[model samples]
Target: MPLASDPIRALHSLLRSTLRITVTDGRIFLGAFVGTDKPMNILLTETEEFRLGPGENPNGRFVGQVMIPWKMITKIEAQESVVQTRNQLDRDVRAGYIM
Candidate 1:
């Protein structure tokens, strides 16, 4: 699909960007936003899982790239969205979700 016409293609622009994703269970995942899908599922690389509350280390655990379901997501936080900023106009981002 052409970048001009592709939906969900903006996810590519976030490549290598840091993101903080919160799930329904109140756990937070901080990682690089790599991709997503039609259902709003997100793909994050170099992830860390954080539980809420102070005194709990923000950098508690590190995991590899994580694929989170749309239904499980409660929030997504990024410093900025490339799609919103419209930077890297020519970059092609691919969205992949297994299963």
Candidate 2:
């Protein structure tokens, strides 16, 4: 069953769960929840660390670990596949179409 089949429920679930977000430009941000007064704008907090390596750098001289509110965010990734699925459903519902 698709999440869009129940838009309200999907959104409720999303709001209730903590999210592991990957921001635009491939930066990861984890937060407790999201708030969006406008569909295009979201607010999140409780972000801790950022990782910029494929693995522990062998050189140990690489630039990794950054703070929150990076300057290159273009989108927010809902870490779980179900979150993505629910987001898609929410969009579909908002569009008055179900998929």
Best by TM-score: 1
Q: Candidate 1: where are CA atoms >4 Å away?
A: 1-9, 81-99
TM-score, cand. 1: 0.66
RMSD of each: 7.9, 8.2
lDDT of 1 by residue, 11-65 (tens): 5656678888899989999898888878877899989999969888765699888
List model 2 lDDT by residue over 1-99, tens digit each: 455577556556576355555666555555555554434344555544355777843333322223335344555555577687677766777788974
In model 1, where is the ten-residue run with the lowest total lDDT?
Answer: 90-99
Clashing pairs in 2: none
lDDT, each prediction: 0.73, 0.54
lDDT of model 2, residue 70:
36
Q: Against the true structure, whose lDDT is highest?
A: 1
TM-score, structure 2 vs. true: 0.45
